[model samples]
Target: MEQLNNTFVAVQAASRQLALLNSKQINNILVAVADAIMEQSLFLLAENEKDLTRMDKADPKFDRLMLTEERLKGIATDMRNVAELPSPLGKVLKENIRPNGIRLKKISVPFGVIGIIYEARPNVSFDVFSLCLKSGNACVLKGGSDADFSNRAIISVIHSVLKKFDTDPHIVELLPADRQATSELLHAVGYVDLIIPRGSSNLINFVRQNASIPVIETGAGICHTYFDEYGDTTKGAAIINNAKTRRVSVCNALDCLIIDEKRLNDLPLLCEKLKKNNVIIYADAKAYRALQSSYPAELLHPATTESFGTEFLSYAMAVKTIKSMDAALEHIQTYGSKHSECIITEDKSRAELFTKVVDAACVYTNVSTAFTDGAQFGLGAEIGISTQKLHARGPMGLEEITSYKWIIEGDGQIRK
Candidate 1:
């Protein structure tokens, strides 16, 4: 057991050493990974189809978690973008010369080896590897068991690319496919610099409770969109429609809507647009009557405060009417998961103030909540949208996996 533990520790130490590489080398590895992702697109799609053969396209769980042609194309485009972004590591953080001839500098560095445990989406396998490598962090991935074949295939292709990049192919690795391997991985928490959990709340919460290693909690976008009194009904209608309807199962899609009490009358027009996009609305008592009279019961669902935290991940939404901005914010604080929130308001003061106050990873003004993505933020690719407030707050791109260390160069300087 002692010798085995030593091997585990070495894996982590090696991963960290590789993460300290210079910017140019890191960029070269990312470029190679991106090229590999594009090259293996067809193989990836075929493997995903095998997985999908067991799943239903219309199934919400399958829909939220499957790989498709468009998604693969999107992934390819994103990896190219990640390859284009400037390498984030090795930037001199600070430089100061001491009177005693000591030059101290803090520099951006990789977090060594990152342990990523995610669920059901195979495309993420490529994205996570790309981001971690670009930021000079080696990663150990454990994807959802449902995607076992796809995960292994993607990792193999990535490793092939790494050989040509002149980097340690082991920089990116995968965890054992066996279910028992997770317990072993968690116990080796000392072997990983940071652990990132991306999946359902149950999975993320499970890792948080069991792992002693540092973990970045993510996923659970029971987010919201507030329509102020001055909301452009046209814009509000369009934005919310696009958000809830465009991709119902994504993390940043709108789950709730808060309309100003003064503008409660707009609910009719709003519901009209939302329903046209095939959205099912869950409304409060006040919004219920307006919706109840305007639409059939099939188009609405009755929800209490408890429903506020629901991330339906379907063509469904919850609508609320509050008296003030404070009231709206309070509701979100009460039930939100701090993922993403947006406000549609013509008033700049209200928009700015709301943006300042909302405690979320991604907050938006007068736009769709679903725009909270790494690509939308123009970073090329995203590993995940982190819900954790520490270390990283929003999209975990190639730049988010690194840490910094103080580098001190002294000429015979001694501590007094």
Candidate 2:
């Protein structure tokens, strides 16, 4: 407990120094870190392979855990992009002169120290660090045991870059990959300003229920896409195929397909590409009958009540048939995880309605839910896709990680 407390205290202390660094200095550090990642890509991959060998290749998280040279390059590119973006700190959100000779200004500031507890995805270590550094916030990472080797390697590279710049490496600390460390970080109330958990629903729930600090829920994407009666079969097929198979382990990957009852005839054609990819389909009665002749018997199964709301994180999806647009909306409301939802329709009114009424962070019209990403949305890179609607609602980037403070200046005005 004492060692964990010391780590937290050091991180909190280093945050003040990190916040004082000018934007140029921070950006230079970020660029250096990105370059360092690329330089040590081979080492990072070897360490990642060590972790990968312990897990089954069939596990969905295996894809997320495994890192290739291409992926490392992408991570580096994201870091460079973050460096190129404008800093969110010190921005004046509001300013006013009071009647009592006092001036007030609300300016953006860092959250002091952010504690992130995530599972399996080692890339998150690099991502959260880049975002927190760019936004002038210190971060304490609690990575799961599944990717401990990878996270350690990534953190070492980051520390080397920080040392090269004469910056305190404790500004970004990685806690031990153990349950005790997680407990310590969660209870570091005075030290950590916020806790963001990015992983499965169970993990997010555990953090939310257990953490003493403020929590921001992310990950666990039970996303859905509605194929309206007026949806183009070709476009719907292409969109569903890309969203499901592009990268099944991602949070934005579609899990449920809502089909307008009138569009049942188009279901088979819409799912043709999915069949080619060998995606398993869990269909309700109506959809099952519709797909009976077209879809492969081995890949098709009757969806249980539990299927609709599941985040497969694999080559699998649930199909629900709705009688009307209202039914589709109701279905989505019942099962959607509020992460991302999409509608493919030729009718503009229906599209507009879906975009407006669907309770999701990201609502799409004729596009894949896979576009719900921080970098893809032009925010450089995201810390996570927040499902909660309080401080943050969607992709958490630099600005999302920051909080604001009211600075008041008085000219010898005393209150009665």
lDDT of each prediction vs. the true structure? 0.80, 0.94
Candidate 2 wrongly placed segments (more than 4 Å): none
- What is the C-alpha lDDT profile of model 2 across 173-215, one tens digit per residue? 9999999999999899889999999999999999999999999
Write model 1 residue lDDT over 1-416, tens digit each, in one string. Answer: 46435546666665756745676776676666666666777887788777777777776667745776677677777777777788787789799998888999999877877888887778778788778777877777877777777888888888787777666667777776665666666667557778888878888889899987888888688989999987999888888888888888788888999999888788888767776666788899888877787866787878776668888878888999899999988988987898998899999999998989989998889888878888888877787888887878898776677788999898787888
Q: Model 1 residue 289 lDDT?
A: 78
For model 2, give the RMSD to the true fold.
0.9
What stretches of model 1 exceed 4 Å from their correct place?
1-29, 56-58
**What local lDDT score does residue 288 receive in model 2, on the 0 to 100 scale?**
99
TM-score of each: 0.92, 0.99
Quote the lDDT for 245 in model 2: 95
